[model samples]
Target: MRALHIILFLFSFLFSGFFINGQEQLTKHATDSIEELVQKSRKLLADFNIKESLDHTTKVIKYAHEINSNVDISRGHYFMACNYEVIQDFSNSEFHYNEALKYAELAKDSLWIIRSLNGLGNVYSEGYKNLEKGTFYYNKSLEIVEKSNIKTEKLGPILNLGWTYIDEEKYDLAYPYLLEAQKLAQELEEIGRIVAINDIKYLLGRYYAGKNEIEKANQLFNEVIKAVESLEIISVLTDTYKAKSEAFQKVGNTDSAFYSIKKYLFYRDKLLDEEKIKQVEIAKANFSLDDFQRQLDATKKEKEYLAKIARSNMVINIISISLVLLLAGIFFFYRGYQSKKKLSAVLKEKNEELQEAKTEAEKLTNIKSQFISTVSHELRTPLYGVVGITTLLLEEQDIQEKHKKLLNSLKFSGDYLLDLINKVLKISKIESNTEKLTKTPTNLIELSRNLLHSFEYQAKSKSNELILDIQKELPGVLSVDSLKLSEVLINLIGNSTKFTENGKIWLRIKILSLEKDEITIRYEVEDNGVGIPEDKKEFVFEKFSQVGREFNKSEGTGLGLSIVKNLLEMMDSEIHLDSKEGRGTKFHFDLTLEIIDEKGENELNPENSGINQKFRRILVAEDNKINQIVTKNLLDLIGYECTIVENGFNALQMVQKEDFDLILMDLNMPYLNGVEATKRIREFDQTTPIIALTASELSEVKEECMSIGMNDIINKPLDKNDLRNIISKNLLG
Candidate 1:
């Protein structure tokens, strides 16, 4: 989340950078209509309307392009790439960011270019696959801006450098850059820059607070609230409130602290609401509200005609009856008049009803879409807990090879399940046009490693390089989401891997300009297997589109690039392609990211200390030999005694039969699963613990196990650390 903030802040800086320096003439003010769309997109990104946000940003970029407005175009890509970074589509982000840089450079717009470079750095540092290169690009950008005489650009680089230091945990090193940025921000009289200054101050304050420097922290907090007060913009209100809340929290003012958090949420949502209202108004103004009434009036006229026909028909009928005696020999006119009147009345009523139904149906469809997207977001947290725990367990060194393999397999399956769930969620959101996006600080290096671990086998089978050319100078953590952005990379990588019979795939990163925020990340999945034609590039992003090729149809659902396009679009990023009809293929795309301040370069490395840890006697309760062997091996490595029993019933007998520190039970035992066995074990030995092993999808299944006196439940594909961590946190810790 801190990383996510860095990315967002970087974007803000990049955009602001465009406002300063020699490139000031590059359309700071976009056209009203496109700007209106851009505003809606900002709101949508806030609301997690990833699809809608992308749709709007795409329009903004197109319009910017149409007008040849370099600044607006740069801003368009800068904002769009944020969401793409969140969704893990580094390639697309790289493409659009590069395009934005091109525009900035074409106009000789250093400010916008600086922002684009910063953004590119963020993508590599946080969103894409290169961190070392990310830092390099970010530094290069800083150097360029330092000489530009643009205080804003200079301030941005200072802030970014400070963050890189902080991420590296060089607190002393981070302070000076931060101090400089704060001073520059004050000099510029910019509320946005001031808001950022307060954040750095607050973080610094937090460090001081952690060190018990209450006075210094309090002074910083004072400045934070002051900065908040100076910014009237509601968009800044969330941070203002949150900063105050944290400050109050540090001061031990609980009521004020809680109030601050509440206020933060309120203002955060309020800003979005205001944007939505404005969007509604703008959309409304685009069309005359009176037009519906005009349609109603036309319908009314038709109804009046029908009524007049009825009246005439009734008169005709009466006249026909009166004249029936005279015209009985020759009249079918009365019958025809009666039929025409009924037909006209029926047709008018049916048409009106049909239109009403269509309107109602559209509304319901929208509601359903919103509900699904909302629910999917809610589901992510719990899934994270399950997957996270499983992953941590696989890292335990004390575990034996057999159990380790089992844990590894389980982890793979769990990841696969998570992917499936995410795919379903994303597809649902996309189909309904209601996908949500959230940006946070992400670790590009760690994320890329995980991607390799997750898909290496699949790649290896095809004999592909699955290459990553990472940069060294990028911010250690840039604000983005690893999950979504990884999704993009995975899609592109998958596309390359699937198409290439036996070829190498590449993801390349570069910094286009240090003077601007544009950091260009190039993803070229060059495959010796096959290539795409230049003509197909434009239409490839269309939903479910597959370039018309005989080999392509058998490869995939064809939504990979479409989803990629949508993901990038949501982030206010653009995509480009260069592919030949033959000579193999190289696919590439770029985006302009908003370069944010880096506090430090962080190293993510977990500890492994088995010798210091102690394991006691454990009672093994499993109905199957295979599971028992897996458990026993893991237990033995961790230096725990295990008495294996074939069934939960026997485990209970043994538990009542003897004393043990922990009991491992299978959920699907012959006589009873772990739940029942634990319940039985609890009859006399309530103090002894039990853990369940099952392949249940629901984490709530753990609750069921615990409800029956089990200590914890380990789902099938058990990780030793799910065992160790559970033991450690619940028992050892």
Candidate 2:
């Protein structure tokens, strides 16, 4: 009896041990599966597959709940928050992130706790634009990181704090946090540290740009853009472009600003499209989950009915089958409804995107127009001094023959530069749809003669013969946009001059048709030079398109032919190109212009007769010393005495004290600008001819100059002949 009792005890103990081992194995497998799901969720989220990531996290959370594992639950909720945030469902994201934080604290997982805190910060700061709330969460994360001495993990919270301050435009407070993050990233050897460094650099660039330190800001922005592009970090690239655009706009660099904003929009649109795709996928996933739940509930009901009908009749079983089929039909109908709803939402979002893009495009156009005007003024200001000095040197009678030749060359180059600037501005105006044709009675014969005469120095330098061939039947006077016509002819002739050496170039006008009211005339510019290749012919008229740069020694901005094409088009004409490689090129265009009889035309040749040279004193208001010297020398050459003032205030003072025949006021001046001074001067003394001198586009300032009681306006680099003519006309009138 004693031996049998001992054997029973041993059997019972071995059976209990086996049961305990089996239970332990099952628990380990379940935990391993949850861990695997959490890892997959993280990867999918990082790849921007928000729906797939959420699905994986959902599975993880379900398994974690079954096992009652706090760590796994925390991880699942953290990833769920991230996916929600990506979809911009901030309320859900905030709830999930809080849940994650609570579970992480329960699990005593510091890494998850920090991540959850940062996630909350991003939700508040970026999505909601609530900087104060965002900063609080970021600081909480930072506090924990500092206490734990986790250097690798601290970079994120620090960077987040800096970003919050920058968003608030509080760069002074942002700098320290950004600097600390940069230093920490530099010390770390983590794989993600490079990305962290780039983030810090981008924030620092924003800080400097806000301070209006453009050069420094641009340098940092360039660096960040290059690195992020290589890393394929699109989000950072978009933000960087937006910041860069704002920086350029602040400094009135309209071109750069426009370019940056375009890039910003492109990337932003790309992101939007990707996000839309994700949203659709998420919607499908939601429908799938709902379908699964309904099917699961139906299965439970069917099983309960089967058990209940086992003891009942066949009629009850048939009724249960009918109910199951009815539920399945309802599920299909619900799915169809969901799909249509999702499609409608997507279409509405796309329409909104298009409207936004259109508005941005219009804004960019306005920016481009402003940029062109600003650049024209800035460029012409310095060019005025260059051209004026060169002209003055050329007029000196005692200049050596060699120096005279050099001066002529210098003058030619200066003139070429001015033409190039004008061409660029013209292209901008044409593209902006601002250019218009203004017709007046013009002498075609004199206009053609002057156009040829202007290119004489250029033709001589290239050993090219310039020929003017006008049909005898062509009318001498016609109503046309002389400025536009002149520009077109100048560009064509200039293009021929640039390519042809030791060749004959002709500017020809043939009367295609003659009528009582108008005449159709075909104009041609033919040159024997390095003709464009057949493949390049089509591209020759493109802006900034150049050909034969390797062989041709001539240098140009490649805008001549394009300007010709645009101007001709504006005049309701088309430019045709004919060329053979290594032979010659001919460009022709036709225009129908109104005939103006010579009997009705009146001409005034202003006489410098009325002014007494000694008594006619001109007061010149100029801030730049070089410009002042140039203006004074030109006036002296014109045989007039002038008093110079450094600024508009001084000019006002001089005008009040002394008597002057005219005041040459430079529009841009120190202390007081020409416009304000003219306003003040007109308040007291209104009779003196205040000829506004400017290096800006004449049309931009002309009306204001005229409205401010100024009698006339003169564009600068002070053309000797124009200066003499304008001064004589104003003084005589």
The candidate maximizing lDDT is: 2
Which window of 10 residues has the lowest lDDT sum in candidate 2? 1-10
Model 1: CA > 4 A from native:
1-422, 432-434, 513-525, 534-553, 589-602, 607-733
Task: State each model's C-alpha RMSD to the native.
Answer: 28.1, 28.4
Tens-place lDDT digits, model 1, residues 512-546: 54434435454444566567777777777765567
In model 2, where do residues sit more than 4 Å from their true spots? 1-340, 368-372, 405-409, 596-600, 604-615, 653-659, 680-689, 709-711, 729-733
TM-score for each of the candidates: 0.35, 0.52
lDDT per residue (tens digit) for residues 127-221 in model 2: 67799899899989988878866555676778778878887899999999998887877764443555667777888999999999999999999
For model 1, give the RMSD to the true fold. 28.1
Alpha carbon lDDT at 680, candidate 2: 98
The whole-model C-alpha lDDT of candidate 2 against the native structure comes to: 0.77
